[model samples]
Target: MNLTPNRKEHREMSTIVSRVRAAYARIEAVARPEIWIDLRPQAEVESEARAIADRVTAGEQLPLAGRLFAAKGNIDVHGLPTTAGCPSYAYEPEADAPVVARLRAAGAIVLGSTNLDQFATGLVGTRSPYGAVRNAHDPARISGGSSAGSAVAVALGIVDFALGTDTAGSGRVPAAFNGIVGLKPTRGLVPTAGVVPACASIDCVTVFARTLPEAEQALSFMASPSARDLPPLPQRAPGPWRIAVPPRDQLGELDEGWAEAYEAAVEQLRSAGAEIRTLDLTPFTEAAAMLYQGAFVAERYTAVGSFVDKAIADGAADLDATVTGIITRARDLPAHQLYTDQDHLTALRTQALSELADADALLLPTTPGHPTLAEVAADPLGANARLGRFTNSTNLFDLAAVAVPSGKVNGLPFGVMLIGPTFTDDRLARIARDLEPSVQLAVVGAHLTGQPLNPQLLSLGARLDRTTTTAPVYRLHALATTPPKPGLVHVGEGGAEIETEVWRLPAEGLGRLLAALPRPMTLGSVQLADGTSIPGFLCEPAALENAEDITTYGGWRPYLGS
Candidate 1:
C-alpha cells in the first residue's frame, strides 16, 4: 500500500513487511466489513509477505513481488472456502485457481475471498447475503456486483488488484461503479479450471486494478499463451483510429448526468484522434438479451442448479431470493431451446462482427448509470438489468473488453468499455490508452511532422500539439544513419534553441515509441523556451563522432533546406 509510487511498486524486500503492515492499517481504517467474506489473518498475510521478500533476496525474479490481491468468492484461494457468494454452498478449495496460482507464483499475495452476488447471479451488489458492498466513492450508491467486494477493495486501495469473474458484466459493472479498471480477457485466455462457474462455457476470469497499465500488467501473468487458431487482427495503417459508438436511439434510458459524461468521453476520444462512427446496437442487444431472456440462463442452471435446488428444499434463507427465483425458473428451459438460442446467437454474432469489421473498437458507456442501493432494492430485477445494458453480450459474441473510468457524473464515477474481437486484447489496450492522460513530446528530426519517419508518430496515435523551441541550450547534430536523423544534445555553455515540434501521445504509447527507437537516440528531459522541461529526443555523444553540427540553423527543417 505504498500509494506514493507512480506505478504499483515492485516492493524491495526491505520494505515488503512494512508495506503489508500499512495495508492492514488502511483496511481497518476503511472499516467496510462487507468488502471481504473471508479476510486472512494479519499474521498469515505478513508471513507470506516475508516469504516473498526472502525469495526475492535469493535472486528470484518475481514480477508481482509483494503485490497483494483478493479473489472473488467464486475463485478458489487455497484454504479459503469457495462461496460464489452463497455461504450455504461454501466448500474448502484444495488449491488456488490457476489464475490465482499464477499470480501467487509471480509473488502476488492473496488476502482472501471477497463478497459477490449469491451464485454470481446479479449485477447489483445487494444480492449477496454478506451485505451490500458500498461504492468507494459514495456509500449510499451500489458498489456493483457480482464482483462487488473485489472492485471496492481495489478502489479503496485495500489491495493492489483483485480477481473477478465475468459472465454477464459481473466484472465490468462493478468496475464502472467503483471507478476502477476491469479487464475481461478473451474467454479461455485465463484458465477457469478452479473457479465456480456462473455460466461455465462463457465465463471469464477478470482483473480489477486502479489503472489500465496495472490491469494490463496483471493480465500478462494471468493469460495463457494463445492456443486457438482465430482470425488475425486487422492491420491498421498509420492515422486516426475508427471507434464505433451506439447511436442516441440505441442507448437505453441514461441519467442526464451520465449521458453528458458519455458524450464528453466520446469527444475526448475524438480529440485523441479517433474517427467516431455510429454502430447499430441491434445485434449486440439481441445477443445480450439471449443471456437472460432466452434459454442461455439455463447455462447458469446447468452450472449450479442442483446446489440451488438443495438449498431451496432445505428452506435456507442464505440464498438470495431474487437469485433463487432466476435459477429455479431457468431449470425448466427445454433442451431444444438452448440450441435454438445458440443458433440465433450465431447469426447475431455474425451481424455484430460485420458491423464492427471496419472499426478498431466499439466504445459504450459501461452501464446506463450508477444505481443507488435504494434503487436496486426498489426493483431488483429492473435496476440490475439496466446496469448490464452495455456489458452482457461481450462473452456471447466472443469478444474481449476493458472497462475504464472516464469521468464523474453527479459526483459519481462514469466509465466506458472498449470491445473488440477475440485476440484483439493488445489492440484494445492501445485504443484504451487514448482515454488516458497524455504527455508532451518534443521531436527534432525525422519524427517531425511530414518528415521521413513522421508516420511512426501517426501510427502510434501521437498528435501534433504545437511548434516550439528548446531553451537556447542545445546543439543539433545530423547523425549519419539510413535516411539520416538529427540529434539534439544539451550543452550548458554554447547552445541555441533548436527547432522542435511538440507532439502529444499517451504515456503508454510513449513507452512503446521509446522502446522501438533506434540506438544512439534516447528520450530525456528537454528544456523548452518557456523554462519547462518535457520528454524529447536526444542522443549519445558517440553518435556525433562524424556528424554535422547544424546548431547554426536553429532547427532540423531549416538545416535541411540550407
Candidate 2:
C-alpha cells in the first residue's frame, strides 16, 4: 500500500512492475472511474512493459530506466485522445509533447494520460467534467489543480513521476495536496512544443515526483532546448545565499495547524544553517493579481478561443460555467487594455526581480491552506482563487520553483516552495535536494565547514560535521587549484593528524559539484574517523606533484588561509 518506493530496496525489475500493476488494480478496485476519463487497457500496459524489459535487457542507459510515469491530458501523447478533462473537446494528438518525448526516450513508460481542469483552466480539480480528483490525504478535500490527476498518481505510487503544466500554480498546488515534490522549472526551460497552451508565454512544463532527487532527475532529462524551444538561459553560480520567507502576517487566514506547520518548516531550514529572513511579498502578490484581474486572461482566450467558440456554437462543449464566463469576458476586453496590462506586468516583474537581488531563493507555503472538495464545490471560483494565493505569482514573475513536502498538518499534507529567478532551475533543485532528508551523501573538501568552498556547500544544503574525522593514517594535501582546493590522500603509516570535516549532500547537488570539479580531484570512498568509509573527495597521486603538502595545517581552510 506504500506508494513511495525506495530504490535502495533493490526491488527486482519484475517486482517493480508487479507493484505498479497491483497499484493500478487497487485503483480499479476502488472504482473512482470518474478520476480519469480514459484508462489504458491492461494489454497496452503489458505491451509497454515488455518493450521496457527488452530495452533493459539490451543494456540501454535509460535515465528513467524502468520507471513509470503519467502526463496531464492537455499534453499530447501520440495515439491518445487529449481531452484536457473535457470529452467534447477531445482530439487525437499525432505526436507526444516534446517534454513527454524526452521522458520516454530516457526509459520512462507512459501509463496513460490523466484528467485535468478542462483546457487547464481552473486551479480547483472540481471543474473537470470527468470528475473531481480527490486529495490523496483526504478524499473529502479538493486536489488543487489543473495538474490534479498527475499529482494523485505520484502520491498513490502509481508512477515514479508525472508531467504537468504550470501557468498559475497548476504544477504546485496538487503537489501540496498530495504531499509530493512539484518542480516548476524556469519558463521555456522545458519545451512546450506540443503542450496545449494555457498561457503560451508563461506556461511551464513541470514534474511531480515522490522525492526531490526523482524530480530533479526528471528535470535534467527534460530540460534540453530544441529548435522549437527557447534558447538556454545563462547559468548562475552559487554564493553566500540569502533565502527569503514570507512574513507570518502575509500567510492570510491559514488555519492554526497550517500556520504551525509553516513555522516548523522554517525552523527546520534555520537549523539546517539557512539564513531565513522575512521579506514583503506585496509586489509579487500584485503581479499574481494581474494574472486573473488584468488582461492576462485574454491570453488564455487567445489560445483556445477559436476552438471554444466552435464547440459552443455546435453545443458540443461541457465547459464549466465559471470558465465559460471568464473566457467570454476575455472576448470583450479591448486590445489597448491588454497592452496596458502587459506593460504593468513588465513593471511588476522588474520590481519582483529587484527584490531578489540579495536572495538566492524565496520560500513560502505552496498554498495558503487546504480546502475540502465540498468547500470548493460550494463556491468553486472563490475557493480555487484562494488556493492560488501563493502560486499565481510564480509564472507571472517568470520564476523557477520546487515544492517540497514539508510534512503534514491535521492529517493533511503541507508543502514549502523554493522560488528562484528564471533559469536558475538547477540552483533551486540543488537547494531543495538539501532540504529533503531522504538523499544522503558524504563530502570532504573545501565544502566542509570553515573551508574555502563551505559557502557553496551551505547553499546546496550541506550539514557540517561535529563529531567526525578522517582515518588517522591519511595524508592531506593542499591542491593548487582555483577557489583553493584540497586533496585527501591515504598513506601507509606515521601520517599526521590531518584535520578534516564530513558533510552530507543531496544526490542532485553532488552530481553538479562532481561535474564542476576540476581535473585531479574526484569523489571516492574515504575512511572516516570511525573506520567506516563513505563517498568523499580524494585526489589522484599524480596531482600531488605540484600540490602543497599541508597535512600539518589540518584541512583546506587553515592551509589556504596561511
Candidate 3:
C-alpha cells in the first residue's frame, strides 16, 4: 500500500507513532469519509501509539506493534460512540471493548469507528444511517455487510486490519466481495464484552486483513478463554487435505457464473494437493434457513429488542424498516415455537458436525456474488438473504471460518470460505493461508519486485512466488519508455533463457496492472524453463524494431547494473 515506504524496516523497528502516522497518511491520500464513521483526531491517535511505542524502549515486545486498524461501529472504541449503525441508539462507551483493548495493548492503532448494517442486522452494507460503503473495487456494488465498513477499510488499505462482528456472514461476505481475508473466529474465542450483539449466543468478532498472516496476527491478541471453546487442533494438519465440497446441485445459482468460479477454487486447492469429497449440503442449508425463517431469530430480539422498542417509541422512521421487521418478528415468536425451533437447531447442529467429521474444513462460496446497490435496494431483505445462503449456518452450528480471496469473475471479486469445526480456528487459518489464490506472473523489468513499478504489484498485494529462467525461446529487449523497461520476446529459435522472477499477485490485480502499463508492453502467457506457462509481460514484436536487444544480460536484474 506504500503506507510505509520503509515497511520492511518499520514493521520490525519503527516507533508505533511513526507507523501510525504513515497509516494516517494513507487514509488521507484516499480521503474516503464515507468509509469511516468516526476517526480519532490524528494527534490523539499518534499520542496513543507513541505511548505504546515507549514500551519497546523499555524492552517489551509486542506482536502487533505499529499496526493500524478500524473497528466496526458496533465494537466499542473508548472515546467513540457505539452506534451499531443506528445513530439514535448511539452511546458513548467508557472504555474499549475487551477485544479492542487487547489489540491496543499489542500496539495496534485504532483509526476510527466504521459503519455497519443497522444494529448489525443486514448483510447488504446499505441498511445504515451512514452512507452505503461502496465496494472497494467497484463503487456501484454493495460492500456486503453488517461488517461492511470494516471490510472496505481493509480492502482500501486504510488500515492494516479491522475488527468486524460476524453473525450470519457479515464478516466473511464482505471479505469475499472486497477481495481480502476475513477470519470469523469460533464464537467466544474473542471476548464480546462492550460490543453490540446481533444474535448474542452466536455472534463472533472477526478480523479482516489483506493477508492471512496479518489477520492471524490480530487474532492472537484478541483471544479470550470461553467455556465452550474446543481444544486447539493441529494447524493445517499435514498430508492430502480432506476438504468437503458441497455437491454441485446443492450450490444453487451464483451471480455472473460464479458457481464455476467457486468450483475453480476447489480445483485450485486440489492443485495444491488437497483431497476433495463432494457431499449433500441439504442439512447445512436447512439449518441456515432456520436462522431467519424459524424461531432462532428471537435471539436477535433478545439482544436488542429493548433498543428497538425505544426507537419505535421515539420515532419508527429513524429505524431501518428491514431491521425493524426482523426484530419485531423475533419479539412476537410464541414461547412454544421458540422451544421447538431450538430443538430443531440442536438436531441440525448435530447433523452439521457429522458432515465435518471426516473433513479438515467445509468449503463454500463466501457469497453468491456481488450485487449492485440498485439490485439490493430493489429487494432489500431478499438480496441480503441470498448473500447469506452459504454463510448463515456457520454460527448456528458453532464453527470457525476464514474467507480467502479465490478469484475474480465478470469484473467482480469472488472468494471461498474454509469453515471448520469449533476451535479449529488455527487449522482453518492455516488452510486459508495455503488456499489464498494468486496468479504466477513472470516479471521482466520494471515490474520485478524491487524495481520502480514493483509498488504497483505490492499495492495489489502481490508476493514474490519465485525466481526462475524462461525456456530457451525468449530474448530480452530494453523498452524505450521514459523510466526504461524490459520486454521479454519469445522467438521460435536461437534465443536465450531470460531470467525472470515470477510474482504471485491477487488474480484480480491483473486488470489494475494492465491499466497502468505503457504501450508496446502487454500481458501474455510466457513459458518458464520448468515448462509452466502463466500470465507474464510481453512486447509487441514491432516495438523491438527500435528497441535495444539486451539478451546477453539474460534478464532485467543484471541489465540494471548499467
Candidate 4:
C-alpha cells in the first residue's frame, strides 16, 4: 500500500494503456468494492488512456500523461453520473467539471468515481450509504471523510492521484487517516462549476497524491486564470516561515501516540530552521463551529434542502439520519438568525486573521485521533466532530491547507496540517516541503532510475525529485560487490558530469539506508551542478584502489546500457 513514486517505471517501463491495464488489475486484485461507488468500465478507462497516449505520441506535452486518477463521486466526469454520495440524487453530466477537464487535458485518465459521506456532509466516512470507506492501513478504522473515497483510491495505489472536494476538511482528514498528501487549495482557484455543492460558497476541489511535487504538478495545471479569487492568490516566494501552533494546553485531548507524533513534527520543523510560535486558535476554532453549530449550517440546507424535503414527504429518503437531521434543521431556521450569524462570522474571520497575522502558516495535527468504525457508530456525531477538531474552520475562515503525513500513532498513520492565509498556497506548500521529514539522496549507480537498486529507494519512502549530473566533480567506480554496485568518489580534477538522481526519503530512514549499503559504499554529501549539496553514496578510497573507474560511462545505469 506504499504509494511511493517510482521514477524508473514512470519514465521508461510501460505504455499508458499498459499502465491502465496494470491499474485495473491492481483494482481487481484488491477487490474492495466499498472503495468506489462506481468504477468506469475497464474498457472505457483503457480507451481514454490510449487516446491520451496517442496525443502524447503526436508531440503533446502532457505533464500528467498516463497518470491514473479517480474523482469523488460528487465531481462530474463527463459520462459518469454525479452522485455526491447520494445515489438517489445522481445526474449524468454533459461535460467534465472544469477541474476534471483540466486534469484530462493534462493527460490524466479517470479510472472511476469514489464514495463519500453522502452529500459530502460528514467528516467520518461512516456516513456514506455506499459503505464506509475503510482506512487504507486498517480496514476497521474510519477513512475520514467526506472525501473518503478519493483519499482511499490514492492510498491504495489504485490510481496515481485522485480528486476530492473539500468544504470542511474532507480533503485533509482522509489523507491523515490514509498517510498521504492532501491539498485543499484556495477556494475558487479551481472551478467548482460542475460539482455538487456541500457548502458551495466555501467548497474546493482538492487533490490527493503520494507526494507533494506530484500534487503540485496537478495544481499548477488546474488553476483557472479567470477565477475571481477574493484574496487574489499571489504566487508568493517560498519561505523560511514562522509557523504558528496552538499552545500545548490548547491542543485539546488526544491519544498519547498522536500527541507524541504532533510534537515530533513540530520539533522536526524547528530542527529544519522554522520558527515555531505558540498561539491561541480560539477565533479559528469559533469560526469552524460557525459552519455547523452556527447559522452557516443553513448553507448545507440551502443546497439540498428542497430535494431532501421532497424525498421525506414521499417517504423515499434513504439518506443517513445525521445528514437528514442537520440539513432539515436549517429548513425553517430563522432568516434573521442566519443573517446575524453571518455578521458574527465576519468578526470571527477577522479575529482569525489577527491571530496569525505575523505567522506564515499554522501547523497543527490533522485530527485529534483515529476512531474505529465501531467507535464512530456508537457516537457518530461526537466522533465526527472530534475528527475535525483541527480542520473545520479552514474554508469558513478563508484559509488554505496542506495535510502531510507526519509519522505514525499506535502503528497507524498520523499527520499534521499546515495552513496559510488565503492565496498563500505557494508559501504554505513551501513550509510543508520544509517540514517534510526527508534526506536528499543522490544516487548514481544501481539505484538510478530503472537500475537494480532503484526499488530500494521506493521502499524507503523515497521519491525521485529530479535527475541531473555531478558537475564533473565526482569519479564513478565499478565496485567489487556481489550485485556489482557502484561507488562515487569526489574528485577535484579530471572528473566528469556523472549523471545522478536526487531522491528524497524520510530523514529517519537514513540509518536503515546506510546499513543496507555494501561494505565499501558510504553515504556522503555530493555537490550537484547547481552547487546544491546532497547526501549521496560514496566510495572508500581503499575499496576503489582495485575498482574499475567507470567515469567515462557517466552513470551506472547507462554503463549497463539501461
Number of clashing residue pairs in every model? 0, 0, 0, 1
Query: What lDDT tens digits, residue by residue, belong to model 3 across residues 51-170?
Result: 666666556777676788999999999989888888888899999999999988887788899988889998989987788888999999989899999999899877888999999998
Clashing pairs in 1: none
- Candidate rank order under TM-score: 4, 1, 3, 2
lDDT of 4 at 137: 94
Alpha-carbon error at 256 in model 3, in Å? 1.8
lDDT of 1 by residue, 1-562 (tens): 2233323234455478877887789899999999999989999988889889877766789988888899999999898899888888989989889999999999999888999998888898889889999999999999998999999999998888999999999889999988888999899888999999989999999999877777888899999966466767667767788999988879878887887888888999998789999889999987887788999898888889999898888998898889988999999989999888889999999999999977889999999888789999999999887788788999999999999888778778888999998888888888887786578899999999889999878755577999989999899998887667898898988999988899987665687688768889999999999999999999998889988998999899998898
In model 1, what is the error at residue 292, expressed in angstroms? 0.8
* Candidate 3 regions with alpha-carbon error over 4 angstroms: 1-18, 225-239, 439-562
Per-residue lDDT for 47-142 in model 4, tens only?
777677666655678878888899999889898898888878889999999889988888888888999998999998888778988999999999
All-Cα superposition RMSD per candidate: 8.4, 10.3, 7.2, 7.5
Clashing pairs in 3: none
Cα lDDT tens digits for candidate 2, 96-192: 8888888889878787888888888888888877788888778898888898988888887677789999999999999988888999988877888
Q: 422 in model 4: Cα distance from truth in Å?
A: 1.1
Q: lDDT values of the candidates?
A: 0.88, 0.77, 0.84, 0.84
Q: For candidate 2, list the clashing residue pairs, or say none.
A: none
Candidate 1 versus truth, CA RMSD in Å, comes to 8.4
Please provide TM-scores, in order, for all candidate models, with all chains considered together.
0.80, 0.76, 0.78, 0.81
